[model samples]
Every structure is written in structure tokens, then in C-alpha cells.
Target: MIQSIQYSLDVIQDEARQLVQKGVVSRQQPIYVLCNYIPAREWGWVESELEKSDFLLRDRIGDLISHENWEND
Candidate 1:
């Protein structure tokens, strides 16, 4: 049986924000760039979550993030 993965918009948004804060990805990149960090097998779940939320793969990370926040290093 195939395992079902659950993804929430808030989770995806928070994840993208974290990735940007950690320098794993930049805000200028497309949302699809996130797939590189997520396992290939799980991208379908993430993609569907994004789609359900009206997010497009071509949407920039900066656009997808609800807000931009930076921590002092």
C-alpha cells in the first residue's frame, strides 16, 4: 500500500521561510526549488498541497512567503 502524506499550507509556508533563513534557498528562486531539498518520493505530496493553496511552481519563494523576516546573525 502506498503511504499517504499530509501537507498543510501553513507548514509549507513555514518550511520555505525556514529554508530561506537557513540559506538553504533564496527568496528569488522559484517555489519548485524546494523540491530539491525534499525527497523526490515526497514531492508529489508537497506539489499537491501547493496547488490546493493556489500556489504555482513558478511562483518565487519571496512571493510564496506570507512575510519576510530576518534574524540578526
Candidate 2:
């Protein structure tokens, strides 16, 4: 058997808003700070924070590195 669940836009939006308010999803400033100012020694801590905020830092960094390599080659 297969099951499917559907959510209404208002429900989805409300859930997303709650996540943002709870720090489970982050705003742009935090992401920018992580990108620009995170120290090497604090990478693990920063990565943990990003994970908690539902950011796929490892996968995103991998993609960015690949793109940069491709651009240079």
C-alpha cells in the first residue's frame, strides 16, 4: 500500500514561519556570518549550528568547490 499526504499553502507557510522563529531555520545574516567570518578552529561548531538550522553545509560546499574547480579548468 502507498500513502500520500498533502498540505495546504497556509499550513505550510505557518509551519515554515514557526521553524524560522524557533531557530530551526536561519536568516540570511547568520548564513552570511558563517560564510564570511567562521574561523577554521570553529568549523565543527558552525557546521553543527548549520545542521540544526536545516542547512546542508557539506553538500552545498561540495557543489561550490566543484563549480570553482570546473571554472578554473
Candidate 3:
């Protein structure tokens, strides 16, 4: 039982770390950052870029990955 618990915790921690890293990358290089040099009215391009970026997709995929690992743990 203790072995199982420890293995589960270790898996969960590793999965969580992956999620955190993905989140940090999404936030740090977000499309919004590109709007800093553009005019306010040009934010649409930045918004569009952000919408198509892997940020949301990565987050959702990461969630699934983490969930799978946690559930088995």
C-alpha cells in the first residue's frame, strides 16, 4: 500500500510540473506581448494570433495528460 501511494504521489508531482511549465511558456510568450509595440487599434492582429496559438490547445492537452497520470496514480 505504501509503495502504491508513493508511486502515485511521484507521478502526480511530475505531471503537475509539466502543467506548470506549459503554463509559464504560454504566459511569458503570449501573443499579447507583441501588441506592446503596435498601436492600440492594431490589437486585433495580436488577438487573432493569440487565438490561433498553441496556448489553449496545449493547456487542454496538458490537462488531459496530467489527469490521466493522476487518475492512475
What total of clashing residue pairs does each candidate reach? 0, 0, 0
Work out how many backbone clashes candidate 3 has: 0
Top lDDT model: 1
Among all windows of 10 consecutive residues in model 1, the one with the lowest summed lDDT is: 62-71
Candidate 2 shows a clash count of 0
Compute the lDDT of residue 22 as modeled in candidate 2.
66
Candidate 1: which stretches are off by over 4 Å? 1-4, 67-73
Query: Model 3, 23: alpha-carbon shift in Å?
Result: 24
lDDT of 2 at 29: 29
lDDT of model 2, residue 62: 25
Query: Tens-digit lDDT track for model 3 on 1-73?
Result: 2221222323433544554465642333333333344456645543443344423423443442344322454
- How many clashing residue pairs, candidate 1? 0
lDDT of 3 at 70: 25
- In model 2, what lDDT does residue 70 have? 27
lDDT of 1: 0.85
Q: Which regions of candidate 3 are displaced past 4 Å?
A: 1-31, 56-73
